[model samples]
Target: MMRQTRLNIRWRLTIWNALAFAFILVAFGIGVYQLLRQAHFDMLDKSLKNRLVTLEESLQEGSSVEDAIRDWVGKFGEHSDYFAFVCDGLQNTVGATATLNQVDINRLLPNLINDYGGTAHDSAFGRIRYASREVQSHGQPLRIYVLAELEHLDEELLLVRRTFLFAIPPALVLSAALSYLLAVRALSPVEKLRLKTDSISATDLHERIAIANPNDEIGHLTATINSLLARLDESFDEIKRFTADASHELRTPIAIIRSEAEMGLHNDADHSRTNKRLSSIVEECGRLTNLTSQLLALSRAESSINKSNMKPISIDRLLTEVVEALEPLA
Candidate 1:
């Protein structure tokens, strides 16, 4: 016995559709996140540059740069804002709004003068946002360094990342659901085909797959299958008719042989009568041989019809040739 294999088109389609949806959604999400991060960094860079310019202008004023810086620093601290520092070439802090402890000044002063000049430096200090600018005063060049706590912007960035991360699960779930529904909708025709096919059996070979539509690939497939089934049904009918006809044709010859043998056996040593019966048996055998040969030829013809390669041919020429070949047999 051969084992039957079960197929489920719905589950197959669902898996394929879900995978496609996930691939597209993940690619889109990565692109959007990268764009957002780039925009954030650009905005932060621009803001740092503007603050550095403001500090430089304030320092160039005729008033005491240290005093002016102290006032600015006091106001900034009152508002819980970022601190600024201005230094001369000697590396000594000339003007600083915030108190410069040894560690704060030491860690920032060298990097401000050497590592950065009129450029934004994000990695100068560990976890500190620092920007610097070079300014000329009284024919002397000075470096102004600005330091701001990155905690606020860092927090905002962290929040954005978390929000996107959290959204991914729901997005994926929604995409999967939509993909499954679409797959189901797309495969409904196939499901119908399955049901129709299941309803038919070998005993009902006369039944065929319905071609509900004729313009699509699925319709074409249904039509082809139906055509095959129709051919099978015709071949089976021809086989049944041939079997019946062959049995009828053979019965007469078999009966004649049996009757002739019985008569010859019952007759009393009549040579003439025995020879006549024997001749009749020989004739019946010849007839049986012819019938069997004809049956075999028909079977071969039917098999050839089923397996032959089809091509365009002139119908009139083909028919004329067939008739000429069959003239003797007819």
Candidate 2:
């Protein structure tokens, strides 16, 4: 039973430690994944915004809308991730790259004036993130849209998640094993104390538990147990002495009674001498009875001393009570 209890404690310790570590590891993994995802998307949005600036500059330089579209396509079209589109105030697609001509301009610019910032939307070519802005070019207000493919971003994030999933189980197992070892090392002293105490018996009260570190809690516990053992040893020694002394005190009176009885029986014809022998025997018997009573009273007093919560008595009342108790015998 005790061995099972110890094993339960170690297992509980290991389990609690593993739980704490898992919580921290999971939280850290989630945080990293979010930060990385946001950072990657932010990079894509910035690239789109930068392309918008380049297109605006080309228009400001007095280039026609067709020339600006041609320049943008020639510069960034080769990169399959990039797409550019432009529209007039009527929201009609005016100029666009081959990559973006496939996208529905109406859906891409649903709220051209209101949705001026960046956002992600699904398209014919998987998912795409785009940014839009209104700018004056060639003395006319034009809306611009720049979209980037989201497939690569999604793929990168998927890889990160898979790596984390693969790493978690082995980390948790290692943590649990380390926690179990630490728990065992920490409880070794207590286990030793239990084994030592189990080997101790009443006859072996002189033996004490070994103390490894006096400043620690286990050391203090061992010291207390040893002190209790010392007190028990003293009590046992006192009991042995009491028993021996009581027997010794009774032996002399018993021997005297026997001798006087023998003498009285041997002198049966002489009545006076027989009477004197009988009187001596009676006196010894009285002594023996008195000795027995005194021994009982002493034993009671010692027993009371070992017990707790003794009430105090007034000396005058105590003396009066003693005198009253002995008056009948007197």
Candidate number of the best lDDT? 2
Query: For residues 1-330, could you state the per-residue lDDT of candidate 2 as single tens digits?
Result: 555534478889999999999999999999999999999988887888889888878877878788997897777666788877888887778788766653556666653334556555655556777777887887888887877778888999999999999999999999999999999998888889989988988898889888888999999999998998898888888898999999998887777777778877888999998887787677667878978977877777778843334468799986875464333234
Counting only residues 3 or more apart in sequence or on different chains, how many pairs clash (N, Cα, C under 3 Å) in candidate 2?
0
lDDT of 1 by residue, 46-119 (tens): 76667677666765764466765765655445333366776677777666654455567767664554444332
Query: lDDT per model, in order?
Result: 0.70, 0.80
**How many Å off is the CA of 233 in candidate 2?**
3.0
Residue 328, candidate 1: how far off, in angstroms? 26
Candidate 1 has a TM-score of 0.76
- By summed lDDT, the worst window of 10 consecutive residues in model 1 runs over 117-126
User: What are the RMSD figures for all models against the true structure?
Assistant: 7.4, 6.6
